[model samples]
Target: MKKLGITLLVATLFVSCSLSKVEKSARKTVDGNWQLNSVTYDEKGVFNTHLLNDVTATCFENSQWFFRSNNSTGTYNILDSDCSTGVRNFRWAANEIGKDSGVFDFTLKFTDDKKKDIEKNTGYRMNLKYLDDNHMQITQTIQFEGKPFNINMNFTRTTL
Candidate 1:
């Protein structure tokens, strides 16, 4: 009976230790190339899906975002089908203001020849959600035309 008790305790301890290790290693990093897969828009509490079918979605169809782990800098390539191709240089930082909060702050500036001389700068504070090895979603709320709009963009990892 004594041997059986000792063996059971050892087994439990082993299992617990392995689980903790797995949990720690399962955290995913945002370093890699990610492609924009889809987006959803919420207006006045109404949710609209299948936003990629619209004509404006063509501008973002071939969009790609590359994030670097070393310096937290990235580039967004906008390969618009109908419009001119452009690239935006951005610096991103993850913010954990709360215990369970995961937010991303991005500052974007045009790097193309035409807009390179322009002083227009865009920034966004978005919440990072459902981030895993292959998939991630970002949500942002903005005011457009005197109305509140919530946009959710989904991405898929394209590089290792």
Candidate 2:
């Protein structure tokens, strides 16, 4: 009984330590500028596409999402080919929705120049996954034409 109790305690400690390490790594890995590289969608089937394949993606071309670690504030710079360039300031955070779960609840809130909420009660929330130090993926599900559509966006770290 003593050996079993000791083993359980060691296992619990190991798991707790591991989770904290992952949380810290996630916070660091997402702090930087990320440029959209590719996009994929699944409605009826998987469709591999690029940023220029669709109107929405095209507008996102040359766009950069900046995530700051200091104040958890960032900016989304949109450089549309046929539209004027604009910047949207926002607050971002890496959060977990459930206890001891590895799932990441990435959230963003767009704010105006005065730091007032522009989105009011709505904000962007998505599942964030880090592929590596310089690559990350964001997944979002939306209802389009009364059907559910899953969109996956892949981004690579940019130096600018």
What is each predicted model's overall lDDT from 0 to 1?
0.60, 0.73
For model 1, the run of ten residues with the poorest summed lDDT:
19-28
Task: Write candidate 2's Cα lDDT for 23-53 as tens digits.
Answer: 6678778888899776667555645333222
Distance from true position, residue 137, model 2, in Å?
0.7
TM-score of each: 0.60, 0.72
What lDDT score goes with residue 31 in model 2? 85
Q: How many steric overlaps does candidate 1 have? A: 0
Off by over 4 Å in 2: 1-21, 44-55, 145-147
For model 1, the stretches where C-alpha displacement exceeds 4 angstroms are 1-28, 43-57, 102-122, 144-147
lDDT of 1 at 39: 72
